[model samples]
Target: MDVLEAIVLVNDMVVDSSSRRNDAWPELDDLSAISSSFYRDTDIAEGYGDSALEMELYRLSIEKTRNLVSSGDLQRQLGFLPSMREIEVLPVIYRDRADFVEKILDSIRSSPKNAGISTELHRQLNGFTQSLNVLPDALQNFALFAFRGFYYQELAHLTSASYMPHSWRSGIIRSQLNRSVSRFADVAIGAGEKVRSKLQAAINDEFGAQVISANFPLIASFVIGQASRRSDLLRTAVEIRDSAKATAFRAWVYEMERRIRNEQDLDKVKQAQDELTTLVRELEVDLGLQRKPTQEMTLTLALPLPLTPSIERTLHVSSPAWVRRVLRRRTHLVFLRELAQESISLPPFVRSYQMLKL
Candidate 1:
């Protein structure tokens, strides 16, 4: 088959998985089987090569080959599934390490213009990924299932490290390690038994039918729910890591929130500020990947709260202290000028019950 045909088939795979309406979930189960079958005899990857349970792998190879090629045609037949691009490519690199490095350097040298732009590119394979996401449905479907196979391989390498055959495989596996490095409160919450139990109990207590919606499936929603708790946990982490004044943390959070809210494309840059500002002098470190954060960092996944809807139904809303602080910050206080508005409690929902002074 021509490269074009191969690309089209990959699109078929991607569309089958990621798109919500696609009736192709079964195909995904098959792709994992395909990956297994492809390596049934390949003993290079240790535990990565057991083919007994790989029914889908056999189906995938047969289906892809039969659909793409005539029964007898063979042009070295060296196509690797896009999802296995990194895995396949890395093995080639390991086999020809010097040649791989030389080619990579040569590519870099040829793309001088890309050097600066690439420096700011946070994700590896970002361009390739963006292009793939916009492909035909068949290719998309293929990719979705294929890449998941790579993840499975990575997971295997981790929990059972003695079987790991190569250091290159360690790259993707490090994400599991990155989980520890991740400062996201949500990650911690999802991984913690106590947090999950609490979150589950809270949802059962409040929604009666689990506040999780279809858009955010149950486990996924729970993961993201912890993200809602970030600001709260961020406060605690910053305090622990930096041992700073509470007001300092508040100021930092305000600045972070503002930067995210106001940032826009360069076209939106109304004025170019001078780079040699007093602020730049104060921040001696550059905002690059090589620069480590000054504060101690740890992944402290936010614990889920048994939040009732009356508390405003959003992240960080459960904390009364936050409400008071937010009011004090006056991110908005337009109504304060009115007599009735001024008379209202800070959050508008603060209890009106009065207490006698001792």
Candidate 2:
């Protein structure tokens, strides 16, 4: 058969198999079966394809399987967060720049982090990154500065006694961070140059000179205030004043906050946060940071952070509390395994987190 016919046959096999199985997770069984054939066919198509039709059939079959799972089966499996499932399914429905943004935010929200200063910083970073493009010129420069401030602040904590002991694992994380920083340094610097150009342009506009001078202190104050919210970071900034790095760190913070007041379009703010979080964890080889208790830190005292205004409104209007409760009860590990089975590459930190428990 042709590619389309082969895809149809594979889908029918999976769907019919699901109907026949009399188990709690017949769908998973169907998935397992289809996944096997998809892989087998994919190998043949890629490696031994004597004709274009054979290659096309194998590729289409694989594509069809992913589409089916992402839209239908993955929902039932990864129901821990409806938004996450929606994120995975969204590509099938909408394929545009705006939707790309939605997809990213959804991915960021789905990323898990421990409750503490780290998590809060992660959220803020995400918000900043996602909103970067839409922000006013002054704000965009501020965001980059603020981002560097937070990055260093968090990096300091990870290097602290409270986060991880000085061991081989810690060394690995440091090495990874070093590499990541090295690789991204040029990119970050290039972006910074652009921001500086924009800042200069804004300054040359009207009364911009006085405004620029005034902006540094305002941003510095905000960065300091944010640092104060996390005892470890605040302690690092204040107590470690002698270090030149600390001085430069705070300078970057002030420089960034000099112009921006607040974030715009909170919903789009996931990229900065997600990227930082992902990179930070990538520093870890395997559970590189030793876990510490933050029970005394009053995590509950922190203000509630709704996903986005629109999501918040929709949740209030439609989704019932019981449904949320049920979603929380879903087996996270099972869903994670299913995602892997479907040939989805789970993020390293996520895989590490789950594996450490086992």
Candidate 3:
């Protein structure tokens, strides 16, 4: 028999053996049994010929096994396989550029702080790198930027709390970040002379290199813009700074308001309010719309207002009681808004107060 026929015969033998066992499914142990039987059968061995055919058979067998497992038939038969919910394995295959980009972003967003890339994401990146030459220029640049961005963000999280007391775990995390940054830089530098020059110009010293590596996404965007002559792709330092500031302001305001709304303790609510007010003032000053005052003070008031509900009531009410509850909440919100507006003098604060209106 030829190689194809021999492989078919082997599969038939395996299936026949499984049927003999009261129609039971084949187990991993069946592989060994089938292998021994194949070697013991002189006719089949002579029919296939040579060590080359043996190797071919081995390779095809492995390929066939993978196909079976991937197709879910073998998976269904094997009770040992983990359930989808218990152990999710994201497929590394990408259908198109959009799918690839979405997967990268989703992985980065869902990854835990300081945990670095997941195995599936790493596999996807490796595949992208291996096929980089065949990929479209736009996709190539995006993939590289995403790879660098993920590591940089991880490094930022690792080093953001450097002021805290160092421990063995922290040291390990820092070491990993350093290695990741260095490896990424080396890869980028090896891409081409132009990339190397850009990276080197930004990196004057070891410390500067670390800083640049940690912010490589911004630099990469600029470099890609220059290379492709696309002004829209360029991200200046000022733009990055403003974007970061806006994001931070929004996040801080949301967190503070969430604390104010959820907090049952009066002291904590007052503290959250004070913190929010200070944040608004700081943001205003940062935007160059206001000057810093020489003296900063926070005023606390003891009011007879009842505690706000932890859960916000919807505006669309069908009952009179719900209407009264909504009106009462609106009154408290208006009082808070007027109080904050009297102290803060910026249109930004007006937006922030509106968020408090819930």
Please name the candidate that would achieve the greatest lDDT relative to the true structure: 3
TM values, all candidates: 0.18, 0.14, 0.18
What TM-score does model 2 achieve against the real structure? Answer: 0.14
Candidate 1 off by > 4 Å: 1-193, 212-358
Q: Taking the tens digit of each residue's C-alpha lDDT, what string does model 3 give over 1-358?
A: 0111122112222221100113322232343253333212112222323333323333333343333334443333322322323122222322244555454334333325413434444454444455555544433433343333233333334334111111111222232233432221122112212332343354556455444321122223222322222222212222322343323433443444455446555575565445434434443444444555443334444446688334433343222344334422443222223222332222222123233322
Query: How close to the true structure is residue 354 of candidate 2, measured as C-alpha lDDT?
Result: 30
Q: Which digits, one per residue and each the tens of the lDDT, describe model 2 over residues 68-182?
A: 2334432233232223322332222122333333432332232243224334434443443454455343333322322222222243343331122111122223322323322
Over the stretch 222-325, how does candidate 1's per-residue lDDT look in tens digits? 22222324323222222222222223333433343344346743332222111112112212222221222233334344436655233222232222344334
Q: How accurate is candidate 1 locally (lDDT)?
A: 0.28
As for candidate 2, its clashing pairs are 125-273, 126-269, 126-273, 127-269, 142-256, 219-257
Q: What is the lDDT of residue 231 in candidate 1?
A: 26
What C-alpha lDDT values do all the predictions have?
0.28, 0.29, 0.32
Best-first order by lDDT: 3, 2, 1
Off by over 4 Å in 2: 1-183, 189-193, 196-200, 208-211, 214-222, 228-358
Tell me the alpha-carbon RMSD of every candidate.
Answer: 26.0, 29.4, 28.1
